[model samples]
Target: MSPRIGYFLSCEEYSPSQLIEQAKLAERAGFEALWISDHFHPWNDAQGNSAYVWGMIGAISQACSLPITTAVTCPILRQHPAIVAQAAATAKVLTNGRFTLGIGTGEALNEHVLGQRWPNTDVRLSMLGEAVDVMRQLWTGESVTHHGDHYTVEDARIYTLPDEPVKVYVSAFGPKALEVAARIGDGLCSTMPEADVVSSFKEKAGPGKPAQVGYKVSYSTDPERALDYAHELWFNEGIPGEAAQVLSSPKHFEQLAPLVTRDAVAGSTVHEADVDKHVAEFAKYADAGYDEVFIADMGPEYEGFFRFYEKDVLPRIRG
Candidate 1:
């Protein structure tokens, strides 16, 4: 069976109004759901904009009927897990239970604003594990008092909540994080089309758990323009390794952006208007066993992007 296809909203690139517009467009374009990025800062200043994701979610809930998930929020830092729990619960109520909280260990790019010491990978993962435990306890509508290794919550309870606990989809990129996702996540969230990742998650999470993956494409009638947008707006995507996870500022990313070549970006993304290529990209994730695949169009060609997908790409994929 074909996996459900959704649209990804890039909060780092678009304003609140634009994000909400894309949410409505995705619904109208026959996309099954929405994945909105949660970031405190853009990877580079060129992609400028980082609205608080909770506020965006509330606004988006009123504007569109499609379900929404934070592409991945870091509840471990920047926001307390208890606060994240309340916000997520309110979001679930606002969306009439269509809101899912997608969480991860997070990056210093967003979490360093508070000037807290950046922990190592093992420590961050441990914090994330504890944070998820704190959130889940609060979601039960009982007063929660948690004093764990990384977080402390005192008699906190979420008053506004949906009938069901907000579903959590954990985002994982490495083996350790994947293990946590399998153990705690109601679903798995990822950006890569890796069959082994999905199979491992399903094996550990057991039957009936869903896995979602998202990626970006730059669509334009002029293929060169598409390539240009991908390179100009998202060269950070080409940055190697843990730089993305450890970089503390957008300037640091901008400084390294020059090292990323257009060809590198081209090799990684579908930066063209070709419907066949677009369909094939989604198929890669579906074939990898993702239950859902989300695509984000980079730059200002989103209107054309939606039209192209709705008319040409989606039907072909569904057929």
Candidate 2:
């Protein structure tokens, strides 16, 4: 089956108003849903914005009817899982159950602001599992007092909750994290178009569990200009491996941004106006068997981006 297409709102690059506007535009353009990044800081200063995601989500719920999911929020640190439970429950109610809580073992870039020691990947994955357990307990609307390895929740109960528990979609890349995700996650969330990963997730997670993937693109009439915009604002996307996860600050990312070349960014992202290229990019996720695919525009040309997808790209993919 062809995957449902959605728009990704880059909170790292767009202001709250811009995100709300994009959400409305995406729905009007025939997009089915929305994915919004949750971040404390932009990857670099060039991207330049990080509004509180929950607050933006509240505003976005009022502005558009499309379902919203945090591309991935880290609940282990910076914010306690108990607090995240309350926030997510409220979001579910605000969206009238059109919300999903997508979570991951977060990055130091966002989690380190509270001065907590950044745990290694294995430890982080363990904490994530416990965090999900904590959140799920609170979502049942019963008072929860969890004294676990990583977290301690005093007598706490979420007063506001939807009719059903908020569905949790886990974001993962490596094997260990994927294992945890399969065990606990209601669905899978990823950015890579790796067929093996999706297949493994389905095999382990069983039927009726959906998987989603998101990718970045730059859209403009002049493809070269689009490449320039992509490199200028999002060159950090080209940074390979664990650097993105361990980097403590936006300045740290900025220092590495110089090493990332235009070709590196161009190679990974579709920075063009060509309909076939955009359709082909979406097809990669569909071929990988993701149930949903989200596309995020890289630069300021988003108005044109929406129009291009509406008139050209979406039809080709759906047709």
Candidate 3:
């Protein structure tokens, strides 16, 4: 197999029943896994989102029969790793071993709200490494009292932990984080499947570890509409600078926020051009040896989008 194919769902916006419907359609359409997003808010301006993730996950478990994981979540700053561990344990029991904990250092937008300190880039990565260490220890179904540099625990045990350790997939962007992932992670998770980054990560990240990538784009009947939506959300995702680096800094996003104006996000997508364009975009990641690719779209035309993909993209790409 050339690696699994997957998609993202917006549990926040969709009603519980609506989420079930789409998840069933996605699984039946042959997507191997479902990677969903977790957010306390939906960007700025309230975007009309921000649903409860735990409840949504519970509903998803009952409604669909496919593997699932958070594309990436920050368990450290906002929520205690203990809570995350408990939730993951319950979800694992519910899903029968179909969930993986995809974790990251976290962004300030979600982490800073609790009045907890949000460290700089390097420090945040350090906290993440410690958090993972702590989470794994707690998940062992043993009483743990970890006293680490960033996090500490006392006589903690999770009897509900699944029979085995939950695979911890670390999300990294640059060199340092990748090294952390290599040191502790069972798998690699990133949104950018850039070949050089993957190669660099694998090089320093060590051997025998698999790499996974996730990316997003919009779908529309008109090329311009698609590009517009894409740019609105993504131009910053590609905004030619250390955005590649400074995601840890809340100010970086605020500074770059102006560039991904309504126009930029809207005008940068490539829908209605060619299905090959979408396939080729994803194929580049597959070509880079990503063990899996999870893609999401942000428009209402996903039914039509998947129809086009199934008829035109999946046959050729899945081969």
Estimate, for each residue in 1-319, the C-alpha lDDT of model 3 and write its tens digit.
6879887776534555766676777787778888877766444321345566666677888888788887677888787887888888887777788888788876666677787766788888888888887888888788989888877789988888777778888888777887888888878888775887677767766787778887777788787777765554444455664443334433455467676666555444445637778888788789888988887775556777677767777777886
Instruction: Tell me the whole-model lDDT of each prediction, alpha carbons only.
Output: 0.92, 0.93, 0.73
Clashes of each: 0, 0, 11
Candidate 1 Cα misplacement greater than 4 A, ranges: none
User: Of 1 and 3, which scores higher on TM-score?
Assistant: 1
Q: What residue pairs clash in candidate 2, if any at all?
A: none
Please give each candidate's TM-score.
0.99, 0.99, 0.88
Off by over 4 Å in 3: 11-18, 205-207, 232-258, 261-268
Alpha carbon lDDT of residue 126, candidate 2? 91
Q: Model 2, 246: alpha-carbon shift in Å?
A: 0.4
Alpha carbon deviation, residue 99, candidate 2 (Å): 0.4
The lDDT ranking, best first, is: 2, 1, 3
